[model samples]
Target: MTATTTVTTTATTSAAAAVTGVGVVLPGLNEPGGLRHGPVAGADPVDPAALIGKKGLRFKDRATQLGLCMAAAALTDAGLLGPRGLLVPGDRVGVVVSSNLGNADTVCRAVATIAEENTGALSPMDTPNASSNIIASEIAIRFGLRGPNLTVCNGVTSGLDALRWARLTLRSGRADHMVVAGVEPDNDVTRRLTGARMVDGGAAVVVSRTDAAGAAAPRVLLGPSFRTEKLPDCVAALADAVPGPAREAAAGLWLGPDPSAVPPGGETADLSGWGDCSGALGLLHCATAVAWADSGRTEPVYALLGGAGGEASGTVWIPVERAA
Candidate 1:
């Protein structure tokens, strides 16, 4: 399909501070079942057996496990514990997750069951988890979220699309708090489908309305989407608009060749890995920005995310604010 661009921002940021929490979930692959600390921008390789134990989670698929793990981590990052029971009961909380290849394991198992049994009878367990909505459904059930729930599968822009949709829902007064996540599991099928070049991982972020002047809130900045075909070109545009220091501290440039090669006026702090999961890359950028802001540095932060369809998408800037 030919790529297209759509831009929408809410002029009204006064809807009871819509989102109060965010969560991310990732799956364990092989070894080192956690985030790796390095200059690479991609996810750390994880051994499923080590992280979840051999018999601990035999029934769940890789994506489901990843989704749950990231969701729990995001809740902790947002300083919330089981937000379903809290967060102004009945105050609409939405869950939006992005995945390009959804539930490959379940699909494979279902097909296998049919072949082995030599009949149309499919495994009941395999059928439910096979849908792309499984991750969204699991998130809803785990957190008791009863608002709008959606699963986006837009090539590489799924994560950013999910965030954009969640923000729109909040601004439209559809929900109060939304949990948006980008998750991908490692499987032979997904690897072949998406041209697997990096390990599997997931990340999530909570976007909510905050008073511009609130002392305890995260630095919130909004700008038009950066549209471009090349990563370096987009970074240059953002650098010109945002301050230099902020650009320097960018956790990682999502696109482009080398950080050092950036023009004289455009110097990025460091180069994280590249092209882990296209859907989750935007969330990873946001998460990195938050980490830098939390470090007490006064520099501005910008996250640049682009998709394979020659589409450039990113937030212009975000400032740090202490929560009230």
Candidate 2:
């Protein structure tokens, strides 16, 4: 989402913010890494080293690998990963990633390894990957992104929060292009808390300022949080927020795991098919909304994310109109 002004109470921007490139790695659909989807929950481990084509990644943890794969995919899809260099200058681009459980299994195993062996045997490489913010740093290092790098470890709302931050960063001219990503891995901690095996996935999208939509790409969407409003309020806000062709889509879309968390009376997409994605669901919603808009059935689509915590994170996409 682009801002018209500084992200004050009523934010605006000189140019509209648009989602130019999108990448999503879903459960059982491993596009980044060549790992097959395991039966049921515990999928075969993904070796992202092969996907990333980097030698030093052997020591990095799974979450970090997942984050890299999604960021690379988004950059690739955006044509930013050209043979020459990044689409934008390294210093002009930023990376923001969010996750609920960051390095859970890594810390658990690190302790087990130290206990089983000793301090001398403990690997120094593993220590750096244990932090929650390592994912963004790793991506920046790999791509030489010298702009702002942020990692959010908040709960379910973290993904949305990351997107919000990216919006502000662009509005403030800190970066010309921002890659916003969200990834969640399956682990013991999440399984015990959710009582179900987590469906691991990573989703990423590139947000930038542009005057027109990419003809082959999906229209860039900008949201004013119409998704968070009540059905009546959402509908009313959407009337002003959406263009003529897509106003109805805003009124008809419903997203979230909890029915009570959102206003009633819209076509609720079945998220059960995704199993348990944990906090990555918020990013998934953003990517899905963009893809759905690409399908020509919708534009400037709106989506709402609700967690078991009963809190809602709503987002809107305002599609960039094609140049005449």
Candidate maximizing lDDT? 2
TM-score of each: 0.72, 0.79
Q: Give the runs in model 2 whose Cα sits over 4 Å from its true position.
A: 1-15, 27-47, 112-121, 211-218, 226-245, 257-265, 307-310, 322-324
Candidate 1 vs. true structure, TM-score: 0.72
Best by TM-score: 2
What's model 2's overall lDDT? 0.65
Which window of 10 residues has the lowest lDDT sum in candidate 1? 27-36
For 83-194, candidate 1 gives per-residue lDDT tens digits of 4433334336668888776587678767787888954587565577888798888877766778899998876556666776777776677765567777677667776766
Off by over 4 Å in 1: 1-58, 82-87, 112-119, 211-216, 219-264, 269-275, 307-309, 321-324
- Give the 10-residue window scoring lowest on summed lDDT in candidate 2: 5-14
Per-candidate Cα lDDT values, in order, are 0.56, 0.65
**Which pairs of residues collide in candidate 2?**
2-17, 3-12, 3-13, 4-12, 4-13, 5-12, 5-13, 221-318, 222-318
